[model samples]
Target: MRIDFSNWKPLTIREVNNIFSRISIYWGVAGGCALDMHLGRKTREHSDTDIVIFREDQQMVYQLLKNEWTLYKAKDGKLSLWLEGEYLDAVSDIWISRDNQSPWAFQIMLMDCEQGNWIYRREKTIKVSKEELFSTEENNVPYLKPAIQLLYKGGSSQIREKDFSDFQSVLPSLSLKEKEWLKEALKRQFPLGHSWMKSLED
Candidate 1:
């Protein structure tokens, strides 16, 4: 079910922490919110907050979230049950809420990783050391790097206006290495040509 609620209020960063901080799971901000967190400012309002968790740590997340929220497999624009202790073999996204009536609190991106290396889901060949996948703000909130977040947004042909805005804001601050990494990743995913690759070179 491509479900959306009438009172769909997103969780604030503080609210996000109030709930999940004690879970003891390897988690951090992802998506547009992450881009803003890395930039140390809120560029725009977010529809929902995204958090990344290792696929291996699914149980821990389930245990941490079970009592309060219902988890649903959000794939191909549809939502379904993400049962406890069940292997999330095909789905990589899960949406959490108190129930269908309430606003969605957050979404979880289940990522693949090995040892301490963070694997790029779109291109398995590309891997980044865990040390480089995320960085912390002055307030200690961890977020996905800008370049990586842009890489994810780049995959869709229907890239939203907000995503383009995020690219513009983040591109200038990206280091030479970060630019190069994003260029290479984009090249692999959009082999023919991608607008962002040219900008990255400049």
Candidate 2:
């Protein structure tokens, strides 16, 4: 089957985890890439890992990873780092929970808590600890879930036709249970766009 995710597997699974393990980078594999992992899709050729990191972790991330990951600034102070062919993008808002940002226009990745914690020592896939991983409470906006990482790259800050298009593609993969929770999540996370969900669903 032809895998149609936006970002392909640019690096080996081990390599992706290794780069992120340093400085406890909080990221997730979102977009078609994440869907592929969930569906057990075969590894295909890719150039980027399609990742998201917290704004607060920037300095710590640079100090530990600059030698390997070169920083490149995108429009609006948005940044990214390239390492061994994979790219990691810095999101505007990451650490705060109540203050919701945007939904990932890409794949969603969890810290692989099932595999292992994000600790470099374990040497296994970095596990996103449950306590650390955030999830949508009852509303629909994106939040971290165990074994999954949510990237907030949405809203007026990143308002682009591409963002909605990406969300539409991933909609089918979400379950009814998720759909039910998401609406509420959206309300709680994005009060401003309480109508945004309706527009997306339409």
Candidate 3:
């Protein structure tokens, strides 16, 4: 089916928190939205919001939203209806909307994990404990740490203008430890070098 990319009306952070309140598994706001949450203000307008969950918990999330929302598996530049109990092992992006005709609401991104450590899907060697991976905002909403979110943005093949904007907006807020962790992660992920590495240095 043809999906309208421009028809995105993402949910607010508080709305997402209420929707996922019943979920007992590991999940948190991710992507640019998470970075904004860490900054305690909306740095810029976002086209969509992202919620992240471990791959292992995909089914649980699927079951939760399946009845009330339309779920589509987005892979290989295609969108298809996500069937019940369908294991999207190779897929990481899932687009959700209130209904087929409604504007897209938010995206659910699946992350790889082992034991209790979060693993970077692009690079297995990069992992961090759950505590280090997420931080709860004063509003009681959980979000991916700014440094980790920046790392994800840096991994994009073509860094967009917004990605750099997010990096710059959150840089001053990051602790020394966070900067060091992100720098080391970028080093391992891009052994040759990354433009952001120099900015992350102490």
Whose TM-score is greatest here?
Answer: 3
| Candidate 2, lDDT over the whole model | 0.40
Name the weakest run of 10 consecutive residues (lDDT summed) in model 2.
94-103
Q: Which prediction has more favorable TM-score, 1 or 2?
A: 1
TM-score of 2: 0.44
Which scores higher on TM-score, 2 or 3? 3
Output the lDDT of residue 104, model 3. Answer: 91
TM-scores, all candidates, are: 0.92, 0.44, 0.97
In model 1, which regions exceed 4 Å deviation? 5-7
Task: Report lDDT (Cα) of residue 144, candidate 1.
Answer: 84
Residue pairs of candidate 3 with colliding backbone atoms: none
Instruction: Return the lDDT, model 2, position 120.
Output: 16
**Ranking of all candidate structures by their lDDT, best first:** 3, 1, 2
Write the number of the candidate with greater lDDT, choosing between 2 and 3. Answer: 3
What ordering of candidates by TM-score runs from best to worst?
3, 1, 2
The sequence of per-residue lDDT tens digits that candidate 1 reaches over residues 58-77 is: 98889888988988897787
Best by lDDT: 3
Instruction: Give the Å shift of residue 41 in candidate 1.
Output: 1.7
